[model samples]
Target: MKDELLIKFLLKETNAREDSEVTEWLAAGAANQRYFSQMELIWNVSKQLAVTSTVDEDAAWNKFKENAGQLDVQRPRVRMFPGKFLKAAAALLLALGAWSAYILLRPGYTTIESAATVRTEILPDGSEITLNKNASLSYQTRFSGNRRNIKLNKGEVFFKVAPDRKKPFVIASGNTTVTVVGTSFNVKYRNDQTEVIVETGIVKVRNGDNEVLLHAGERALAGKGINLAAQKNPDQLYQFYRSRVFIAHNTPLSRIVEVLNENYDARIRVADPEKAALEITTTLNDENLDHILEILALTLKLTVVKEGDEIILK
Candidate 1:
C-alpha cells in the first residue's frame, strides 16, 4: 500500500490509493517527519524562480500547450504549471523527473524542409543533419525537456550530434531505435530494413533482443525479423556517408531503382529479379533519370517501359 502511493505521488499522477497512502504515512509519527521534510524541499524548490525555470537541456521540459503550438507562453493544452503543487511523492516525482523532456523546440513537431539536392541542416539544439535527394524529415519542436525523440519513416539522412552530457537524441523508425549521447552518423530507413552507417560517433542500435554499439566506420543493419546484421567497416561501409553519393559504382539494379524513386521521384521497377540483381558499373553524372535510364538500357541491353510513375523492366 505504501509503495504504490509513493510511486504515484512521485510521478505526480493521481489515483484512488493516493489518499490511503497519505493517511497512513501521516498517521505514523516518524513517517510524517520524513514526508513533511521532503514536501518542504519540494515547495522550497518550487518557490525559487531560478530553480523552477532552470531546465538546462537535460531536465527535458516536456510541458505541452493546449493548442500545443507553443510552449512556455501559457496555453490551455499546457499540462500544468511547474509552480503548481503536483500531488506526488518523492520517488514518483524522481522517476518522472527522468521523463521531464521538451518537445521539438518548434511549434509543430519540427518540420525539416529542404529544396537542394544536397544540403546540411541543424536542429534547435545544435545537432547537424545532411539531407540527400528529395527527403522530408519531421520531428517535435519541444525536444529538450521530456523527449529528445524524432520519427523517420522514409529517406536517407546523416547526423552529427553535439555532446550534451545531459540529454540524448533518439531516432525511431519502424522497429529501429538509434540512441546517442554525442555522435556523427548516417541512416537510410526508407525501405524494409534500416541501414545505419556511423562515421565518427558512439551509436547504439536497438532492434528486438539485439543491442549493438557502433564505434566508428561501422554499420548496423536492422529489419522485420530476428536475423539482425552487424558489420564492421575498415572504410567501405561508411564510404557513402563519408562523402554523400548520388550515384554508386557497380551498384545493384534494385538499389538503383530505390534510390531514383526516393531521390528524383522516378519510380522504376525491375520486374525480373534476374535483371534487378544485375550490377550497373557506371557513373550517373549530372544527367536526369530519363537520360540515366536510357544509358542503362543501351549498356545493359534490357527492355524498359515507363508507365506513369511505374517503370517496368523485364
Candidate 2:
C-alpha cells in the first residue's frame, strides 16, 4: 500500500473500493493487523490531544517554517517540497475526523466469554452473571427504554438481575426463554435441555406451550417435546462451582462425572452404564481431582483406572 492511500484509509476518507481494499489488507496477515492497530492508537491519541490542547495551526505553521529554515542552512544539499507541508497538515485534520466517524459509525454488541475458567460480569442494568467455562453471552450495546435482553449462546450462566418492574430481563437459551424481575437463578443449556434453578425471587421459564413459574428454593427443567416441571431443589450442589462446596443428595454417579468433566476438562468414563446409574450422597470441599476420585471409587465400590489423560471407573 502507498503511504498516501494508507493515510487516507486511517482518516476514514476512503471510497468504497479503497475501503474494501483496506479490509482485505487487514485480513491478509497479522503484520497488517498490527500496523492498523498502531495507526488507530495514533489516531485516538491525536483526538485526545486535540480535546485537551488549543491548537493554532497558523501559528504552528509559522513556527515550523522558522525551524525549517535553520535545518535547511545546516543541510543545504537537501530540497523541500511545498506540497509536503500542506499534505502533513491535511493528514492531521483527517486523523481527527477518523476518530469522530469511528465512534458514530461502528456497530457492536457486548460479548463475554469464558475459556478455561469461570467468569463473572455485571451488565448495564446492574444484573450480574457468572459464566461457566466455554460459555458466552451477548447483548446489544444499549439496554434501555423498558427492556434488557441477552442471549446465552453456549454453556451455563448464573444470573442475578436487578429489579425493574417496568423493564423485564429476558434470556434466550436454545429453545427455552427465561424471564425474571429482581431474581437470581442458574440456567444451563446442554444436550437439548434447559435447566433453571432459582436462588432467590421468582423466575418464569418457557419452552413452546410449556411454562413454569419458580420461586426461591425451586427449580425447573425443560426440554424439547417435554413439558417444563418445577420441583424443590433440596440440595444446592449446583452452586458448587461458585461456592467451592459440592453437596450431593442421591445424585447419580453419571451426573457427578458430567460436572467434573465440564469444569476440569477431564475425560472420565464408567465401565458399565449400570455403574453410572447408581446414586451416591456425599459432600466434597475444595478437594483435588485424585482425592475426589478416590472417595467416589471407595463409596461406589468401583475400581478406578488411570490411563494417560483418561480415567475409567469399573
Candidate 3:
C-alpha cells in the first residue's frame, strides 16, 4: 500500500474504497500489521506530546539521542544489528517529529468508563453525563468544527447537554444515532439495541434511514428489525441509576427483577412464571438488597428463598 493511502486512512480522510484497500493490505501479513501499529503509535504519541504548550522539541530530541546512546553502551546485544537498529531509530524520530505539527491540529478522543458504580463527568463543552455501571463513553477532548460528537460504547448513560445551536450534540450508540440541541436524555445501549428517553428538550433518534423525534416523556428503541418510533415512556425506572431510587408504577415483577439484578450484586429470579407477571407499585429507595426483597415478599404475599447465590421469589 502507498504511504499516502495509509496516512489518509490513519487520518480518516479515506473513501470507502481506500479504506478497503488499507484493510486488505493490513491483513496480508504480520509485518504489515506491525508496521501499521508502529505508525499508529508514533501518530498518537506525537499528538499527545504536541498538546503541551511548553514542550521543547529540540530538548526532547537531544534527550532521546542521549538515552539511545546510553542504551547502546549498556546493552551490547543491540550492537549485533547496529545498522538496522540505528536506521529504525532514526526513521522513528523523523516520523515522530514530522507528524507532530499535523497531529497537533487534529482533534482526539477522550474516553470515560464507569466500573462498578455510576460516574458523573463534565465534558469540555460544559455538558454533564452520568454513566451507569460498566458504561463506556468517548468524546472529543475539545469540541471542534461543527458538532460535539460522543460515542456510547456500551451500557447506559444520561446526558444533560449544554445548549449549542450551532453545534448539535450527537451520540452514536450501536446502530442508533441521536442528535440533540440542549437536551437531557437517557440512552441505554445493550444486546444490540439502543433505547433513548428524552427528559427535557427534543431528541432525534435515527437507525438506518428511519428517524424519530422524541420529546420529554417520550422514548424510542432502535435495533435489528425494530421500527424507529416514539412512544410514551412507561416508567421512571431509567432514572434509578442517577437518583439511586427505583420508582415502579404498576410495573411487572419480571421487569423489576431485571433492574434489581442490574443494580445489585445478588441474582433475583421468580420461581413461578405466573408470579413474574404480578404488578408492583412502589418506590424502592436506597435500601439494601435484602430489605428490598423483604418488602417485595410482604407486598406480594410471596416467599423469598435463598439458594446458594440466587434469590428466588415464589
Candidate 4:
C-alpha cells in the first residue's frame, strides 16, 4: 500500500482488507515497520498541532521576510527594445491579426438541408452524402488546407467519402466522432446513441479513448466512457431510407418494420411481438406501400389494417 493509503489505514478510515494489507507490509521488514512508525509519529504530531492553535500567522510571515532579506537573491533586469525591433514586432503583430481574421472567416460553410425528404449532396472534396429526412450536413467549403470535417446536426446520414489520405474525413455527432481516410458508412444519431455502420473501407469511431475500428458490413456503438463495441452488422436496412430499396436476407420482420417506419412518413407497427422474430428474405424496390404490405400480410399470414396515419400489422 502507498504511504497515503497507509495513512488512511492508520487513521481507521480504510476497510479491513486494506488494514490487513498495510499490517502485512509493515511486518515484512524492519524498514517497513520503521517507515510506518515514523508516519504514525507524524500523524500523532499533526493531531496535536490541530488541537493546539497557538501559532501566529502574521508573526511567522514577518520572521520569514526578515530571514529571506538576509539571504542574497539575484533578480533579472528588463531590457528596452530598439526602434527597429519595435517596428518589426508591430509588423509581426499586424500580420498575425490578419492571419487570425482569415482563419476565423475561412471560406465559410456549405450546409445541405434535407427536411422531410431524402436528399444527396456532393461535398467540396467530391465525397457524397445521402441524408435522411430532417437531417442536415454542414462542412467547410475549403477542404484543401483544413481537415475534411462534417457535422450531422440531426437525424441520420450515409457518407460515401472520397479518399484523401493526407486529410482524413471526420464526422462529429453529439459526443461521437467517426474518422476515416476514405469510407462509405452510415451514422445515425438516435435517442442519445450514435451508431456507425460501415459499408466499405474502414472507420474509426471514438468517444474519448474508447474507440473501435469498423470495416465493411461491420457496425459500432460509441458513447460516453468508451462503451466501444463492434459486431457484424445485423442488416443494411438503414440504406433503405436513402436508396428507397429495402433488401433483406433472412432478416426479422421487426427489424424490417423498424427501417420501414424510419424511411416512410407513416409508422409501421407490428401488433404481435411473437411474429417479429420471423425471418424474411425479400427485396423491396420502389414498390407501393399497399402492394408491399399486401405481400407481407400474405407471406407471413398476418392481417394489415390501416388506421389513420399508422399501419398496424396483426
Report residue 193 deviation for candidate 1 (angstroms): 5.0
Per-model lDDT: 0.62, 0.74, 0.78, 0.72
Best of the candidates, TM-score:
3
- Cα error, residue 150 of model 1, in Å, equals 3.5
Model 4, span 48-83: residue lDDT tens: 444333444344334333433322212211123223
Q: Which stretches of candidate 1 lie over 4 Å from their true place?
A: 1-109, 113-119, 132-148, 164-167, 190-193, 215-217, 232-245
Q: Poorest 10 consecutive residues of model 2 by lDDT?
A: 70-79
Candidate 2 per-residue lDDT over residues 181-201, each given as its tens digit:
788999888887888999999
Instruction: Tell me, by lDDT, which candidate is best.
Output: 3
Q: Model 2 clash pairs?
A: none
Instruction: Looking at model 1, report the run of 10 residues with the lowest lDDT sum.
Output: 98-107
Ranking by TM-score: 3, 4, 2, 1
What is every candidate's alpha-carbon RMSD to the true fold? 14.3, 16.8, 16.0, 23.2
Candidate 4 to truth, TM: 0.65
Model 1, 1-314: lDDT tens per residue?
Answer: 23234434554665667766666677787535454455445444544433344333212322223222223332212243332333222222343343231121223466675555766788878888887665577765646343467776576788888787667888887898999988888887766678788878788899888888887877888987756666874333233423534455667778877666656666678888888888877654456677877877887787788688688876
Model 3: CA > 4 A from native? 1-106
Scanning candidate 4 in windows of ten residues, the lowest lDDT window is: 70-79
lDDT of 4: 0.72
Candidate 2's C-alpha runs over 4 A off are 1-108
